[model samples]
Target: MRKYLIFIFIVLAVAGCKKKNKAVTSTIPGKPALTTPAQNSVCISGTIISATESQVLFTWNPAVNTDSYDLVLKNLLTYTSTTINTIDTKINATLLRNTPYEWYISAKQNSSSTTTQSDGWKFYNSGAGIVSYPPFPADIMYPAFGQVITPSNGKIELYWAGNSVGNNIASYTVCLGTTSNPPAIKNGLTESQLKDVAVTANTTYYWRIITFDADGNYTDSGLFQFKIQ
Candidate 1:
Protein backbone atom coordinates (compact mmCIF):
# COMPACT_ATOMS: atom_id res chain seq x y z
CA MET A 1 0.00 0.00 0.00
CA ARG A 2 2.92 2.43 0.76
CA LYS A 3 4.59 1.73 -2.61
CA TYR A 4 1.30 2.25 -4.46
CA LEU A 5 0.72 5.63 -2.78
CA ILE A 6 4.25 6.79 -3.71
CA PHE A 7 3.64 5.82 -7.36
CA ILE A 8 0.37 7.79 -7.46
CA PHE A 9 2.09 10.84 -5.99
CA ILE A 10 4.80 10.66 -8.64
CA VAL A 11 2.20 10.56 -11.43
CA LEU A 12 0.44 13.68 -10.09
CA ALA A 13 3.75 15.59 -9.84
CA VAL A 14 4.66 14.78 -13.43
CA ALA A 15 1.26 15.94 -14.70
CA GLY A 16 1.50 19.21 -12.81
CA CYS A 17 4.97 19.85 -14.25
CA LYS A 18 3.68 19.31 -17.78
CA LYS A 19 0.86 21.79 -17.22
CA LYS A 20 3.25 24.49 -16.04
CA ASN A 21 5.54 23.95 -19.04
CA LYS A 22 2.62 24.20 -21.44
CA ALA A 23 1.52 27.51 -19.92
CA VAL A 24 4.97 29.03 -20.24
CA THR A 25 5.33 27.94 -23.89
CA SER A 26 1.98 29.48 -24.80
CA THR A 27 2.88 32.94 -23.59
CA ILE A 28 3.06 35.02 -26.75
CA PRO A 29 3.38 38.81 -26.99
CA GLY A 30 1.21 41.00 -29.20
CA LYS A 31 2.55 43.21 -31.98
CA PRO A 32 3.33 46.87 -31.43
CA ALA A 33 1.43 49.37 -33.60
CA LEU A 34 3.04 52.46 -35.13
CA THR A 35 1.44 55.85 -34.51
CA THR A 36 3.50 58.60 -36.09
CA PRO A 37 4.35 59.24 -39.75
CA ALA A 38 1.04 57.88 -40.82
CA GLN A 39 0.76 55.46 -43.73
CA ASN A 40 1.58 56.94 -47.12
CA SER A 41 2.11 60.33 -45.53
CA VAL A 42 3.95 63.00 -47.54
CA CYS A 43 5.82 66.17 -46.55
CA ILE A 44 6.02 65.62 -42.80
CA SER A 45 7.21 68.85 -41.18
CA GLY A 46 9.09 69.69 -37.91
CA THR A 47 12.57 68.70 -39.07
CA ILE A 48 15.31 70.71 -37.34
CA ILE A 49 18.26 71.71 -39.55
CA SER A 50 21.07 72.90 -37.28
CA ALA A 51 24.70 72.10 -36.51
CA THR A 52 23.35 69.53 -34.04
CA GLU A 53 20.58 68.36 -36.32
CA SER A 54 17.40 67.03 -34.73
CA GLN A 55 16.45 63.41 -35.07
CA VAL A 56 13.21 61.98 -36.38
CA LEU A 57 11.08 60.82 -33.45
CA PHE A 58 9.22 57.56 -33.90
CA THR A 59 6.26 56.60 -31.72
CA TRP A 60 4.14 53.51 -31.30
CA ASN A 61 1.51 52.01 -29.07
CA PRO A 62 2.42 49.67 -26.22
CA ALA A 63 1.78 46.01 -26.74
CA VAL A 64 0.49 43.45 -24.27
CA ASN A 65 2.99 41.02 -22.75
CA THR A 66 5.87 42.78 -24.51
CA ASP A 67 9.11 43.30 -22.61
CA SER A 68 10.69 45.45 -25.34
CA TYR A 69 10.31 46.64 -28.91
CA ASP A 70 12.42 46.78 -32.06
CA LEU A 71 12.12 49.75 -34.40
CA VAL A 72 13.22 49.48 -38.02
CA LEU A 73 13.70 52.48 -40.29
CA LYS A 74 14.70 52.25 -43.92
CA ASN A 75 15.74 54.86 -46.48
CA LEU A 76 14.07 54.06 -49.79
CA LEU A 77 16.63 55.94 -51.82
CA THR A 78 19.77 54.76 -50.10
CA TYR A 79 18.52 51.23 -49.43
CA THR A 80 19.86 51.48 -45.91
CA SER A 81 18.06 50.25 -42.80
CA THR A 82 18.50 50.87 -39.07
CA THR A 83 17.20 48.68 -36.28
CA ILE A 84 17.10 49.76 -32.66
CA ASN A 85 15.89 48.04 -29.53
CA THR A 86 14.08 49.86 -26.72
CA ILE A 87 12.14 49.18 -23.60
CA ASP A 88 9.90 52.17 -24.18
CA THR A 89 7.53 53.20 -26.98
CA LYS A 90 9.55 55.89 -28.76
CA ILE A 91 13.00 56.51 -30.22
CA ASN A 92 14.79 59.45 -31.88
CA ALA A 93 16.74 58.54 -35.01
CA THR A 94 18.89 60.53 -37.42
CA LEU A 95 17.62 60.20 -40.97
CA LEU A 96 18.50 61.42 -44.46
CA ARG A 97 17.21 64.65 -45.96
CA ASN A 98 14.93 64.93 -48.99
CA THR A 99 14.29 61.22 -48.70
CA PRO A 100 11.30 58.93 -48.36
CA TYR A 101 11.42 56.24 -45.68
CA GLU A 102 9.42 53.30 -44.37
CA TRP A 103 9.27 52.11 -40.77
CA TYR A 104 7.82 49.30 -38.67
CA ILE A 105 7.90 47.97 -35.11
CA SER A 106 8.23 44.53 -33.58
CA ALA A 107 7.13 43.46 -30.10
CA LYS A 108 9.48 41.16 -28.22
CA GLN A 109 9.63 39.32 -24.91
CA ASN A 110 12.83 38.20 -23.29
CA SER A 111 11.42 34.83 -22.38
CA SER A 112 10.03 33.93 -25.77
CA SER A 113 11.71 33.72 -29.16
CA THR A 114 8.54 34.62 -31.05
CA THR A 115 7.85 38.20 -32.10
CA THR A 116 4.98 40.10 -33.70
CA GLN A 117 5.34 42.84 -36.30
CA SER A 118 3.17 45.81 -37.13
CA ASP A 119 2.08 47.00 -40.55
CA GLY A 120 4.69 49.12 -42.32
CA TRP A 121 4.27 52.88 -42.91
CA LYS A 122 5.98 55.40 -45.17
CA PHE A 123 6.68 59.16 -44.96
CA TYR A 124 8.84 61.77 -46.67
CA ASN A 125 11.27 63.98 -44.74
CA SER A 126 10.95 67.76 -44.93
CA GLY A 127 14.43 68.47 -46.20
CA ALA A 128 16.10 71.88 -46.73
CA GLY A 129 15.28 72.27 -50.43
CA ILE A 130 11.98 71.70 -52.17
CA VAL A 131 12.03 67.91 -52.44
CA SER A 132 8.80 67.73 -54.36
CA TYR A 133 9.75 70.17 -57.08
CA PRO A 134 8.97 69.59 -60.73
CA PRO A 135 9.94 66.33 -62.42
CA PHE A 136 9.40 64.62 -59.08
CA PRO A 137 9.95 60.88 -58.89
CA ALA A 138 6.97 58.53 -58.83
CA ASP A 139 5.90 57.38 -55.35
CA ILE A 140 5.15 53.68 -55.11
CA MET A 141 1.63 52.91 -53.88
CA TYR A 142 1.02 49.18 -54.05
CA PRO A 143 2.90 46.14 -52.81
CA ALA A 144 3.68 48.56 -50.05
CA PHE A 145 7.15 48.80 -48.50
CA GLY A 146 7.81 45.43 -46.83
CA GLN A 147 4.60 43.76 -47.86
CA VAL A 148 4.13 40.00 -48.28
CA ILE A 149 1.83 38.44 -50.85
CA THR A 150 0.95 34.76 -51.02
CA PRO A 151 1.53 32.74 -54.16
CA SER A 152 -2.16 31.93 -54.39
CA ASN A 153 -2.87 35.66 -54.92
CA GLY A 154 -1.91 35.25 -58.58
CA LYS A 155 -0.25 38.06 -60.58
CA ILE A 156 0.90 41.09 -58.63
CA GLU A 157 -0.27 44.62 -59.41
CA LEU A 158 2.28 47.40 -59.13
CA TYR A 159 1.01 50.95 -58.58
CA TRP A 160 2.45 54.39 -57.86
CA ALA A 161 1.43 58.04 -57.58
CA GLY A 162 2.56 60.15 -60.52
CA ASN A 163 4.56 63.33 -60.21
CA SER A 164 2.43 66.20 -58.95
CA VAL A 165 4.62 69.00 -60.27
CA GLY A 166 4.08 70.66 -63.67
CA ASN A 167 2.83 68.67 -66.66
CA ASN A 168 6.37 67.40 -66.87
CA ILE A 169 5.75 63.68 -66.43
CA ALA A 170 5.82 62.43 -69.99
CA SER A 171 6.22 58.73 -69.17
CA TYR A 172 7.13 56.25 -66.44
CA THR A 173 9.30 53.12 -66.34
CA VAL A 174 9.48 50.14 -63.99
CA CYS A 175 12.44 48.00 -62.96
CA LEU A 176 11.90 44.74 -61.06
CA GLY A 177 14.36 41.97 -60.18
CA THR A 178 15.43 39.45 -57.57
CA THR A 179 18.40 41.63 -56.60
CA SER A 180 18.99 45.26 -55.78
CA ASN A 181 19.25 47.89 -58.53
CA PRO A 182 16.90 45.83 -60.67
CA PRO A 183 17.26 46.61 -64.36
CA ALA A 184 14.38 48.19 -66.22
CA ILE A 185 11.84 45.43 -66.77
CA LYS A 186 9.25 47.62 -68.43
CA ASN A 187 10.11 50.98 -69.89
CA GLY A 188 8.16 53.84 -71.42
CA LEU A 189 5.03 52.92 -69.45
CA THR A 190 2.50 55.79 -69.77
CA GLU A 191 0.23 54.71 -66.93
CA SER A 192 0.79 55.07 -63.21
CA GLN A 193 0.17 51.38 -62.45
CA LEU A 194 1.05 47.98 -63.93
CA LYS A 195 -0.73 44.63 -63.66
CA ASP A 196 -0.25 40.91 -64.41
CA VAL A 197 3.43 40.77 -63.45
CA ALA A 198 4.57 37.20 -62.73
CA VAL A 199 6.31 36.42 -59.45
CA THR A 200 7.56 33.27 -57.73
CA ALA A 201 6.66 32.06 -54.27
CA ASN A 202 9.08 32.43 -51.34
CA THR A 203 11.13 35.03 -53.18
CA THR A 204 11.89 38.70 -52.59
CA TYR A 205 11.77 41.34 -55.32
CA TYR A 206 13.16 44.86 -55.49
CA TRP A 207 11.57 47.48 -57.70
CA ARG A 208 11.96 51.12 -58.69
CA ILE A 209 10.34 53.71 -60.93
CA ILE A 210 12.02 56.05 -63.41
CA THR A 211 10.15 59.17 -64.44
CA PHE A 212 10.81 61.17 -67.59
CA ASP A 213 9.64 64.73 -68.04
CA ALA A 214 8.68 66.49 -71.26
CA ASP A 215 11.79 68.66 -70.97
CA GLY A 216 14.04 65.54 -71.02
CA ASN A 217 14.58 65.61 -67.25
CA TYR A 218 14.28 62.27 -65.44
CA THR A 219 14.08 61.14 -61.82
CA ASP A 220 14.29 57.73 -60.12
CA SER A 221 12.16 56.53 -57.23
CA GLY A 222 14.52 54.79 -54.87
CA LEU A 223 14.31 51.07 -54.30
CA PHE A 224 11.44 49.22 -52.52
CA GLN A 225 11.15 45.55 -51.60
CA PHE A 226 8.43 42.94 -51.08
CA LYS A 227 8.37 39.20 -50.44
CA ILE A 228 6.27 36.42 -51.89
CA GLN A 229 4.53 34.21 -49.38
Candidate 2:
Protein backbone atom coordinates (compact mmCIF):
# COMPACT_ATOMS: atom_id res chain seq x y z
CA MET A 1 0.00 0.00 0.00
CA ARG A 2 1.32 3.50 -0.55
CA LYS A 3 3.79 3.28 2.27
CA TYR A 4 1.05 2.15 4.59
CA LEU A 5 -1.17 4.97 3.56
CA ILE A 6 1.60 7.43 4.25
CA PHE A 7 2.24 5.85 7.64
CA ILE A 8 -1.37 5.97 8.59
CA PHE A 9 -1.61 9.61 7.70
CA ILE A 10 1.34 10.50 9.86
CA VAL A 11 -0.13 8.70 12.86
CA LEU A 12 -3.40 10.47 12.73
CA ALA A 13 -1.66 13.81 12.44
CA VAL A 14 0.41 13.21 15.54
CA ALA A 15 -2.62 12.30 17.59
CA GLY A 16 -4.43 15.43 16.60
CA CYS A 17 -1.54 17.55 17.73
CA LYS A 18 -1.41 15.82 21.08
CA LYS A 19 -5.07 16.40 21.73
CA LYS A 20 -4.80 20.07 20.96
CA ASN A 21 -1.88 20.48 23.32
CA LYS A 22 -3.81 18.82 26.16
CA ALA A 23 -6.75 21.13 25.72
CA VAL A 24 -4.63 24.24 25.90
CA THR A 25 -2.75 23.24 29.04
CA SER A 26 -5.84 22.42 31.08
CA THR A 27 -7.59 25.79 30.85
CA ILE A 28 -5.76 28.17 33.27
CA PRO A 29 -6.53 31.78 34.14
CA GLY A 30 -7.81 32.59 37.64
CA LYS A 31 -7.39 35.37 40.22
CA PRO A 32 -10.13 37.47 41.82
CA ALA A 33 -11.28 36.92 45.44
CA LEU A 34 -10.19 39.22 48.21
CA THR A 35 -12.91 41.36 49.71
CA THR A 36 -10.91 43.09 52.41
CA PRO A 37 -9.27 40.45 54.49
CA ALA A 38 -6.38 40.75 56.83
CA GLN A 39 -9.03 39.33 59.05
CA ASN A 40 -11.83 41.44 57.68
CA SER A 41 -10.04 44.72 58.27
CA VAL A 42 -10.93 48.40 57.75
CA CYS A 43 -13.47 50.22 59.90
CA ILE A 44 -14.29 53.79 60.89
CA SER A 45 -17.28 55.42 62.55
CA GLY A 46 -17.32 59.09 63.50
CA THR A 47 -19.99 61.78 63.43
CA ILE A 48 -20.17 65.51 64.06
CA ILE A 49 -23.37 66.32 62.24
CA SER A 50 -22.52 70.01 61.70
CA ALA A 51 -20.39 72.89 62.94
CA THR A 52 -19.23 76.37 61.93
CA GLU A 53 -16.73 79.20 62.17
CA SER A 54 -15.41 78.07 58.84
CA GLN A 55 -16.33 74.38 58.48
CA VAL A 56 -16.13 70.86 59.88
CA LEU A 57 -19.00 68.53 59.06
CA PHE A 58 -18.26 64.80 59.35
CA THR A 59 -19.69 61.37 58.66
CA TRP A 60 -18.35 57.86 58.01
CA ASN A 61 -19.30 54.25 57.17
CA PRO A 62 -18.40 52.79 53.77
CA ALA A 63 -16.13 49.93 52.85
CA VAL A 64 -17.29 46.65 51.39
CA ASN A 65 -15.30 46.08 48.22
CA THR A 66 -13.26 49.17 48.44
CA ASP A 67 -10.90 50.13 45.70
CA SER A 68 -10.06 53.43 47.27
CA TYR A 69 -10.55 55.61 50.37
CA ASP A 70 -8.04 57.23 52.70
CA LEU A 71 -8.46 60.38 54.77
CA VAL A 72 -6.36 61.69 57.65
CA LEU A 73 -6.81 64.96 59.52
CA LYS A 74 -5.02 65.21 62.86
CA ASN A 75 -4.41 68.44 64.67
CA LEU A 76 -5.55 67.76 68.18
CA LEU A 77 -3.95 70.96 69.34
CA THR A 78 -1.36 71.15 66.64
CA TYR A 79 0.00 67.64 66.66
CA THR A 80 0.05 68.28 62.91
CA SER A 81 -1.05 65.84 60.21
CA THR A 82 -2.74 66.50 56.91
CA THR A 83 -2.40 65.67 53.20
CA ILE A 84 -3.71 62.30 52.20
CA ASN A 85 -7.16 62.27 50.72
CA THR A 86 -7.48 59.74 47.95
CA ILE A 87 -11.09 58.88 47.29
CA ASP A 88 -12.71 56.98 44.51
CA THR A 89 -15.60 56.20 46.77
CA LYS A 90 -15.93 58.28 49.98
CA ILE A 91 -14.30 61.38 51.43
CA ASN A 92 -14.75 64.21 53.95
CA ALA A 93 -11.99 66.00 55.81
CA THR A 94 -12.73 69.60 55.02
CA LEU A 95 -11.75 71.88 57.89
CA LEU A 96 -10.63 75.43 58.57
CA ARG A 97 -11.43 76.19 62.20
CA ASN A 98 -13.66 74.90 64.97
CA THR A 99 -10.55 73.24 66.37
CA PRO A 100 -10.01 69.87 68.06
CA TYR A 101 -9.82 67.25 65.34
CA GLU A 102 -8.35 63.78 64.91
CA TRP A 103 -9.31 61.42 62.15
CA TYR A 104 -8.26 58.15 60.45
CA ILE A 105 -9.39 55.89 57.64
CA SER A 106 -8.00 53.43 55.03
CA ALA A 107 -9.24 50.79 52.65
CA LYS A 108 -7.89 49.91 49.19
CA GLN A 109 -8.15 46.64 47.39
CA ASN A 110 -7.92 46.28 43.67
CA SER A 111 -7.26 42.63 44.38
CA SER A 112 -5.37 43.59 47.48
CA SER A 113 -1.75 42.94 48.19
CA THR A 114 -1.82 45.02 51.38
CA THR A 115 -3.26 48.33 52.65
CA THR A 116 -5.72 48.51 55.52
CA GLN A 117 -5.84 50.69 58.64
CA SER A 118 -9.02 52.08 60.03
CA ASP A 119 -10.45 52.66 63.51
CA GLY A 120 -9.45 56.00 64.95
CA TRP A 121 -11.37 59.23 65.47
CA LYS A 122 -11.89 62.11 67.87
CA PHE A 123 -14.05 65.21 67.37
CA TYR A 124 -15.01 68.55 69.03
CA ASN A 125 -15.78 71.63 67.00
CA SER A 126 -19.31 72.66 67.84
CA GLY A 127 -19.54 76.09 66.33
CA ALA A 128 -22.42 77.91 64.65
CA GLY A 129 -24.86 78.36 67.50
CA ILE A 130 -24.00 81.73 66.01
CA VAL A 131 -20.51 82.95 66.92
CA SER A 132 -18.76 80.83 69.62
CA TYR A 133 -15.75 80.94 71.93
CA PRO A 134 -16.33 84.18 73.76
CA PRO A 135 -18.77 83.44 76.53
CA PHE A 136 -16.79 81.06 78.70
CA PRO A 137 -14.81 84.07 79.82
CA ALA A 138 -14.95 84.90 83.47
CA ASP A 139 -11.33 84.34 82.81
CA ILE A 140 -12.28 80.90 81.54
CA MET A 141 -8.97 79.16 80.86
CA TYR A 142 -7.11 82.37 81.39
CA PRO A 143 -4.73 80.90 83.87
CA ALA A 144 -1.72 82.32 82.06
CA PHE A 145 -3.56 84.15 79.35
CA GLY A 146 -5.32 87.02 81.10
CA GLN A 147 -4.33 87.06 84.79
CA VAL A 148 -7.55 86.99 86.87
CA ILE A 149 -7.46 84.01 89.23
CA THR A 150 -9.74 84.34 92.23
CA PRO A 151 -12.39 82.36 94.16
CA SER A 152 -9.86 81.48 96.79
CA ASN A 153 -8.77 78.87 99.31
CA GLY A 154 -11.41 76.15 99.39
CA LYS A 155 -9.15 75.50 96.41
CA ILE A 156 -10.98 77.33 93.63
CA GLU A 157 -9.87 76.68 90.06
CA LEU A 158 -12.95 77.46 87.96
CA TYR A 159 -12.86 78.24 84.27
CA TRP A 160 -15.84 78.54 81.92
CA ALA A 161 -16.43 78.42 78.13
CA GLY A 162 -19.35 76.97 76.19
CA ASN A 163 -21.62 79.47 74.50
CA SER A 164 -20.26 77.67 71.46
CA VAL A 165 -19.29 80.05 68.66
CA GLY A 166 -16.20 78.81 66.93
CA ASN A 167 -14.02 76.47 68.89
CA ASN A 168 -16.82 74.48 70.39
CA ILE A 169 -15.91 73.16 73.85
CA ALA A 170 -19.42 72.23 74.96
CA SER A 171 -19.30 71.68 78.70
CA TYR A 172 -18.58 73.80 81.78
CA THR A 173 -20.44 75.59 84.55
CA VAL A 174 -19.51 76.11 88.23
CA CYS A 175 -21.84 78.43 90.08
CA LEU A 176 -22.20 79.88 93.58
CA GLY A 177 -23.12 83.53 93.32
CA THR A 178 -23.92 86.84 94.91
CA THR A 179 -26.22 88.13 92.18
CA SER A 180 -25.25 88.49 88.56
CA ASN A 181 -28.08 86.25 87.41
CA PRO A 182 -26.92 83.13 89.21
CA PRO A 183 -29.64 81.04 90.88
CA ALA A 184 -30.00 77.61 89.29
CA ILE A 185 -30.61 75.17 92.13
CA LYS A 186 -31.77 71.69 91.28
CA ASN A 187 -29.40 70.86 94.08
CA GLY A 188 -27.24 73.69 92.80
CA LEU A 189 -26.08 72.89 89.27
CA THR A 190 -24.47 69.83 87.69
CA GLU A 191 -24.86 69.21 83.97
CA SER A 192 -22.13 67.64 81.87
CA GLN A 193 -19.81 67.91 84.86
CA LEU A 194 -16.04 68.20 84.36
CA LYS A 195 -15.11 68.23 88.08
CA ASP A 196 -12.97 70.60 90.20
CA VAL A 197 -14.87 72.63 92.76
CA ALA A 198 -14.33 73.45 96.48
CA VAL A 199 -14.67 77.23 96.61
CA THR A 200 -14.50 79.93 99.31
CA ALA A 201 -11.42 82.09 98.80
CA ASN A 202 -11.64 85.87 98.34
CA THR A 203 -15.22 84.93 97.43
CA THR A 204 -17.05 86.84 94.69
CA TYR A 205 -18.14 83.94 92.53
CA TYR A 206 -20.92 84.20 89.93
CA TRP A 207 -20.99 81.76 87.04
CA ARG A 208 -23.03 80.81 83.94
CA ILE A 209 -22.75 78.25 81.12
CA ILE A 210 -26.10 76.64 80.45
CA THR A 211 -25.58 75.61 76.81
CA PHE A 212 -28.11 72.81 77.15
CA ASP A 213 -29.35 69.59 75.51
CA ALA A 214 -30.59 66.85 77.77
CA ASP A 215 -34.02 68.19 77.05
CA GLY A 216 -33.49 70.95 79.62
CA ASN A 217 -33.10 72.97 76.43
CA TYR A 218 -30.46 75.63 77.09
CA THR A 219 -28.18 78.27 75.59
CA ASP A 220 -26.86 80.66 78.21
CA SER A 221 -23.16 81.33 78.45
CA GLY A 222 -23.25 84.77 79.93
CA LEU A 223 -21.99 85.92 83.34
CA PHE A 224 -18.58 84.76 84.54
CA GLN A 225 -16.58 86.95 86.87
CA PHE A 226 -14.30 84.98 89.19
CA LYS A 227 -12.56 85.79 92.50
CA ILE A 228 -11.07 83.00 94.60
CA GLN A 229 -7.47 83.92 94.82
Q: Cα lDDT of all candidates, in order?
A: 0.79, 0.47
State how far residue 144 of model 1 sits from its true place (Å). Answer: 12
Q: Which 10 consecutive positions of candidate 1 have the poorest summed lDDT?
A: 128-137
Give the per-residue Cα lDDT of candidate 1 at 222.
80
TM-score of each model, in listed order: 0.61, 0.21
What pairs collide in candidate 1?
Answer: none
Per-model clash counts, in order, read 0, 14
RMSD of each: 6.8, 20.3
Q: Write model 2 residue lDDT over 130-212, tens digit each, in one string.
A: 23232222224433332456544455444443332233443444544656777753232433443456656555666654554
Return the top candidate by TM-score: 1
Please, what are the lDDT tens digits per residue for candidate 1 over residues 64-103?
Answer: 9899999998776566899999999988877766666779
Give residue 60's lDDT in candidate 2 (0 to 100): 49
